[model samples]
Target: MSLFVTYVLVLGRSLESSRGLLELLTPALELEVDDSPLSLSLHAAAIQLWCLVNSRSFSSSDKILTEAYSRLRTAIQDPLQRGCESTVLAALLLQRYERFSAVWNQHEQCHVHRNGALALLRQQKLDGINSKHRGYLISQLFHSEVNICISKKISFQASEITWLRDQDLSILPSNPSTALDIIGASIASHQHKFTLLSAEEFITASKPDLSQWYQDLQDTEDQLNNWPSTVPRHWLPQTLQSGKHFDQSIITYAGYSDIYPNIQIASIWNLWRTYCLLLLQIKLALLGLFPNLDEPTGTTQDPRIPAFKVKSVQLAQVLVDSICQSVSFHLGNYIEPTSLSELMIPTILCTSYHDMDPSHISYTLYQKSSLFMSRDDHRRHVIVQGPWHMMGTLSHVLSILADSESHIPVHALREGQMNWVRTQFLRVLRLLRIDLEDLSATNQDHCQANPGDLHALNTVNSEIIAKRLMAALAG
Candidate 1:
C-alpha cells in the first residue's frame, strides 16, 4: 500500500478500536466476512484518493472518485441500504474524498454528502444510538454542514435539524463528554444564527427589530465570556514570550515554537472567538456602524459608533493574533490532515475580515514575504505545507491584498512575491471558473468605494458566487 493509504488505515483503525466499534468498521485488516461491500468499497476509495492527493496523481484520483461515487449512488438508491451504519460511514468517507479532491466549483457536492448523512441519521434514528462511533460521525457531519453554510453564504436548514443546541457551560465541570457534545452543538447553533442574520431577506427586507437582534448578540457574547472558565487551562489562550534570539530574522520572529499539549483545542477556542467577531461585524453593518479614522462632523453620526468600531477591531485583532501564534506550534508538531482542515476555516475567517490588523509584525512580514518570495524558494524554506483547501483561503487573502488599492502601496511588495500571489489568485479563480472580466470590474468598483460600501460589495459578490456554484452543482 502507498504510504498515505497506510497512514489512513492506521489512524482509522486506532479510532475504530478506541470507539470499540472494530467489528463494525474495520480499517486495518483486509475485507472481513461481515463487512458490507459498500463499506469496503468506500474504504478502498478513500485510501486511494489520499494516496493520489499526496502523490499529485490527479488522473488516477479522478478515476477512483468516479468509481466510488458510482457505487455510492447505487447503494444510496435503496432506502434500507442507505439507512445502515455502513452506508453512513461510506457517506462520511465519500465526503472526505470530495473535500480533498473536488475542484473549486464542485465543492457543493460536499454539502450534498452532508445532507445525505443527516438524512441517514434521521431515518435510522442514529442519534438515539449511543455508540461512540455514532457520536463521532454526527459531530463530523455537523461541523461539515456548518462550514458549508458559512462558506457558501447559504441559509442553515434549521427546521431540518432541531436537535442541535447551544453549549451548556454548567455541565463542563463534571462531564468532558457532555462538554464536547455541547461544544459541537453550540457551534451549529451559532452558525445557524449567523446564517439567519446574513441571509438576503434579513439584509434587504424592511428594517428589522433591532431589539431582538441585540439581545441575541448579547446572549452569544455572554456564552463566549463564560466559555473560557469552563475549559482546562491549556486550552485557554497563552501568551507567547519572545525567544532569546528574537531579532535573528523574519522567519525566526514568525516561528514562535511554543507547543501546547492541547493546541488543537486552543485553536478551536480561537476559532469560536473569530466567529463571534464575524457576527459583530454583521451586527455593526446592520446598524450602519463602521470604522472611520476620519472624524465625522455631521449630525448623522452616533457618538457611540466610533467606540463600538474600536472595540470590534480590537477583539478581532486579538482572536486573529492568538490563532497566528498557535500556527508555529502546529508547524513544529505533526497534525493529521483532518485536524489541519479544521484549522483552515478559522484562518479563512480571520483573513476574510477586511479591517482587522495583524497583531504581530512577523505576520505582516510573512504575508509580505508570501507576496514577494518565489514559490519554489518559499516552499523549500517553509516548515509546514498547509492542506489544499487552504488555497481557497489564500484566494480570499489575495482579494484583500488586491482590494487595498490606494490604502496600500503596490510598489512596496517585492516584485516576485507580488507576482506570485497574483498568479495564485488567478489560478484559483480559473479553477473555480470565475470570470476574470467580472473580477476586474469588481476590483475597479472597490477601488472607488468607501469602506462600508466595499464591505457590502464584497459580501454581495461572495453570496452571488456561492449561489451560482451551488446552483450549478444542483443542476
Candidate 2:
C-alpha cells in the first residue's frame, strides 16, 4: 500500500516535472498493474493527471509515451481488465495526438485490447472516474478520433464531432478568448504541416504541368474572390491591402511602416480558415501528384479508421471555409521607398501589444494577425509572408485533414448538418492587388522627385486635416 502511494506520488511528481520520467513510468505502471483491475483504474487516472502538466511536447516525448503505451496494448486473458486499460490508453493517445487512427490501424492485429479500449470508453456507467474528468477524457478521445478519421480515409458517425463541440467539458475555467487562442494554435500546428506539403505541390505542379496546376490554383483563387462581404464566423474582416512600398504609421508597433497610411490591417476570420486552405492545397497537390489518381489514391495508404467511409466534398468545403475565415490582410499605402530594413516586421501585433493600433481599428485585427507574427527580428522576414504562403507549404497535412474520405468517424470530426459559408476572397484579393499596384506606381512616380517633397506634402495634408477637425470641434 505504501509502495503504491509512493509510486503514485513520486511518479505523479516526476511526470509533472520531467516528461522523460513520465514516459518511463507510463509503460511501467501499465505493466505492473496489468493484472489488477483497481491498479489499472488508478494508473489510468494517474496518466490523465500526469498529462495535465507543463511539458507536453508531442513529437519529442513520443519515445517515452510509446514505450509506456506498448504495455497496455496486449490481448489480456481478462477481457474486462484489458478493455479498461485500452480505454485509458486510447484517451491518453488521442489527447496527445490526433493521428491515433493511423496508430490504431498499425496495431489492429491485436484486436482484444482495441476492442476492450473502445468498449470501456463507450460505457458511460464506469465507476471511479467523475463526470467532469469523464468529459475531459471523452473530449480528448473525440478530438483524436475525429482528426484521425479526418486524416485517414474512413467513415465517421455524425454523433462524434457534435458531441465534442456541444459537450460541456468545463471542469476548468476557460476564457473564450484564450480558448480561441488554443484552438488557433492547434489548428495552425496541423495547418503548418499541410502547408509544407502545399509548397511541395506547388513545386511539383510548377515543374512540368505548370499550366494545369497554376490554372487550377487560379480558378480556386477566383472562387475565393467571389465570397460575400460577410465572413464565415468570428472573422474580423474579409478584405485588406498592402501597398507596394513599406509602411510607417503602424510600424511603431504593428509590423513595418516605412511610409504612413500604406498598411491596412484587419482580421480575417477563425481557425477553420487556416484548416480549409491547407485542405485545398493538399487536394491540389495530390491531384498534381497523380492527376489520374483514383478516388482512393491506392498509394495514399489504408484509411485511418478501421473501415469508415470518407467524405471528400463536404470536407473540402469545410477546409475552404476554415482558411478563408482565418486569414487577415495587411495593406501598404505610401510606404518608404528605402531599403527593406527600414520596414518593421509585424511583431507589435501580439496580444501584449495589440492595443497599439495606429488606425484605431480595434483589437480584432491586432489579435488575429499577431498570433503568428513575433517581434523576433532574426525571423522577421521569414514570418512576414501571408498565411497562405505558410499554409501552402504544408499542403499534405491539410490535404489529409481536408480529404473527408481520409477521415474515419471519430467523436470530433463527424458529418454534421451542412452549413453554407459565403466568401469573396479571390475577388477581394484581385481588387486589392490592383488597387495596391496603382498606388505603388503612383508612389514610384512621386519618388522620382525628392522624398522630402512627399514628406512635405503629407505634413501639409496632416495640418489641413487637423485644423479642419479642430475648427469643427471648437464650433
Q: Which candidate is the best by TM-score?
A: 1
Q: What residue runs in model 2 are displaced by over 4 Å at the alpha carbon? A: 1-63, 70-91, 94-117, 124-128, 149-154, 158-475
TM values, all candidates: 0.56, 0.30
The 0-to-1 C-alpha lDDT of every candidate, in the order given, reads 0.42, 0.32
Kindly list the per-residue Cα lDDT of model 1 for residues 1-475, writing each as its tens digit: 3333332333212221121122234542234232443444455555554444343344554655566567667777876666556666666666555554454334455456657777777666664433345655555555554545454445455535545434222312232323333443444454455446546665554323444555555666666566667754433343344333222121111344332322223334544554554455454554442223123334255566566656655565554344445443333221222222322233221111011134644334434431223322222112222222223333333332343221222343333333433433333333223443435566635533532221233332432343333332320
Clashing pairs in model 1, backbone N/Cα/C closer than 3 A: 371-417, 371-418, 372-417
Candidate maximizing lDDT: 1
Per-residue alpha-carbon lDDT of candidate 2 for residues 47-123, written as tens digits (9 for 90 to 100): 43233222222244344445444544542333554444344544343332322222212222223332344456555
Tell me the number of clashing residue pairs for each predicted model. 3, 68
